[model samples]
Target: MMRTRFAPSPNGPLHLGHAYAALVAHDTARARGGSFALRIEDIDGERSRAELVEEFLLDLQWLGLEWDGAPIFQSHRLPGYAAAGERLKAMDVLYPCNCTRAEIAAAATKFGPDGPVYPGTCRNRHVDPTGAAWRLDTGRAMALTGPLEWVDEIAGRRDATPMIFGDVVLLRKDLPASYHLAATLDDAADGVTLVTRGMDLFPASHIHRLLQALLDLPVPTWLHHPLLVEPDGRKLAKRRGSPSLGDCRRAGEDGRAIATALREGRFPAGISLSQGIHQTP
Candidate 1:
């Protein structure tokens, strides 16, 4: 059976953008007689909040989105992430790096899809592994996997060029796993067949494809849908302080109606949809 998921972090309240993504995942799975699962991406110890998980669940329910099975929480899967990191370490494709953001920003000369491309400063250095991040050796990883490709429902077939992001982090100094590692592993563990998310994350699939090949995980098809944006074309985000669904619910607004309107390309004034440009993290 085809499976899709809407994994949301519990660092903030759900906004209309979250609503759109959830509805797309839910409706697509239901339409094909498949399953839609919800995964709470609450692994960020510094930012993730236990209370917000319940709030987001309430918002999802209010929006008439029902996920199959009990929700998966990343916090409970730390050991699995650690094991995956160890597997990569065993492959000799991971190296410890202690570069600070300031150090990287000052030293990096080229920018990749996710930000300043890592200069491989620690690739050859004897940095202390303590309190250091684990970075994937993208060049070596690609050489081992050879040329690869993944298909997106909207973007068509594309080559997997993980090098664009340089040697991306697989494990962070403070977090058990980076977004790329954890999300890929979680999807495979959940038997998810279709990865539905916003177009802004389209570039991430390249790195994910590499990880899947390295870990010998099942590859899933993807749908990078358009994003809900403001009138000025800024993608709605929690950091931008987008209005929360809780606010709408408290005002007695109809959640389903809002979802229907969104499906029909009808958004509130100053809110629009866009195929957002590829972003830098």
Candidate 2:
């Protein structure tokens, strides 16, 4: 059976954008008689909040979306991430990185697709690799995998070009696993067959496809939905004061009604959906 997941971080209460993303995965699974699961990405020790995790569940329940089994927490899966990191290290495709953000920014000559690609400052520093953030040598890894490709339900076939991110971080400075490593591993671990997310993340999928090849993980189809934007064309973000779903629920608004409006392409005041082409639900 098809399996999809709605994975959200517990750093803040979910907003309408998150609601639409989750609804896409939920309704897609239901439409195909597939399984829907929820995963809590709380590995960020600095920002993750236990209270927000509970609120996430409550908000989803209020939305009338049912998920299978208990929600998976990234915090509980650190050892697995560590193991994966070790595997990449053994393969010699990953190296220790010790450069600070300021140092990289100063040394970067030009920005790549994802911000300034690391200048590989520490790529040959010969420092002790332990307890340091790890980076995937995208060029070297791609040489091993040769050519690769992935399919999106909306955008169709795409050749994987992870080098655009340069040497991407596999383990973060503040956390054991980076989003590229954890999300890829988690999807395989949860048996997710379809990866549904926002169009803004379409580029990250390139890096993810490379990781799957390196780790020998299961491949899943992707569905990148349009983003929810403000009137100024800025993406809605919790850090930017976007209203949370809990706020609407507490205001006695109907969750199902809001979800229905989103599904039917209706928007609330001060909000607009992205102009990106739609994908089948």
Candidate 3:
């Protein structure tokens, strides 16, 4: 049986974009007679709020989406991430990186898909494994995996090009794992068959594919749907003042009606779908 998941971070209240993604994931699995799971990606360390997790659950319940089994929290899976990192460390493909964001930005000359690629300043430097962030040596990793590809239900087949993000971080100094490492590992661990997410994450799939190859994990198909955008052509984001689902609910808007509209591709006033795939920063 196919399994899918709707993983959300509890750093803030759920928004319209999140609702759209969750509904799509839930409905898609149901349409396939498959199982749908909800995962709390609270891997953001101190930034993730416990209260927001309850709000997220309530919002999903209001939308009439039900998930199978108990939700998995990333915070509770630290040991698994550590084990995966240890495997990578044993493979000698992982290297400790101590460079800060500003330092890399200042040193990087050319831009790649995921912003200015890391200049590999600390690529050769040795540091305490537990104290420094670990980065995948993209060049060596590509050489190890050779040519690879993953299929998207919408975008079709894509060549794996993780190097576009340069040597991406797998584990952080303060956190047990980076998004790239944890999400990929968890998807495989949960036996997710289809990954439904926004088009903005299309590029990140390349890295995930590579991780699957390196970790010897199961590969899942992808579906990168268009993002919910405003009239100004900007994607809805909390930082940009996008209203939360709670805000809409408090104003007496019917949650079921909103969910139905989203499923039908109808959006609120000034909100539409964006077709562009975005670069991760």
Candidate 4:
């Protein structure tokens, strides 16, 4: 059975971009006689707002998106993440690093899709596990997994080259798991077969594919759709003060009508679709 999910963090309001992504996941599942699931990525205790979770549920309901069951919260799956981390440790592909942002910025000589790639300062050092993040030794991991590939609905088959991101973090010092670790596990746990998300996150599939290979998890196809952006080509984000679904709902706007307009590619004035990755500014 085909299953899709729209996993969103509850750190901010759900903007138009989020609505489009949700609709893409929901419509795709419904069209194929599949199930659509929602996952609340609220593990970041410092940033995730408890109030926003309810608001997000209300927003999705207002948009007429009925998920298969109650939303799965990442916070409830810490022990699973911890167990996964230990498995990776047994594989000897995980290493602890205490590098601060300032330290990495000063030492990093290369930049990846996300930001300054880690210079592997702690790769050879035995850092204290206390308050240290666990980073995947991508080179070592690739050596173990060999070459890998994943299928995308739009991009077709592509080789998995996770090295571009360098050694990515699987577990954070403050959080039990990073986005890559938690999301990949949660999707597999929910039996999601199609991972629908924005094009901006297309690069992340490389890492996720590698994780699947290491963890012996089931692989899923992906659909990286274009994002709704501002006239300036910047993706609509909550931090950018983009108009949110809540704002629209409170203004007496019809959620279904808005969804229909989005499905028809008829965005509101000043909002457009961006096919490429845009820097959040």
Candidate whose lDDT is highest:
4
TM-scores of all predicted structures: 0.97, 0.96, 0.96, 0.97
Between candidates 3 and 4, the one scoring higher on TM-score is 4
Global lDDT of each model? 0.92, 0.90, 0.90, 0.93
Tens digit of lDDT per residue, candidate 1, span 45-155?
A: 879999988888888888888998899999999999999999999999999999989999999988987789999999988989989999999999998999999988877
Candidate 1 residues lying further than 4 Å off, grouped into runs, are 277-281
Candidate 2 per-residue lDDT over residues 30-129, each given as its tens digit: 9999999999999888799889988899899988899998999888899999999989999999998888888888999867656788988877779676
Give the root-mean-square deviation of each candidate in angstroms: 1.6, 2.5, 1.9, 2.4
Give the per-residue lDDT digits (tens) of candidate 3, residues 137-215: 9998889899999989987888887878899999888888998999999999899999999898889999999999999
50-139, model 4: which lDDT tens digit per residue? Answer: 999888888888989899988888899999999999999999999999999999999999998889999999999979988899999999
RMSD of 4: 2.4
lDDT of 4 at 231: 89
Candidate 1 or 2, higher lDDT?
1
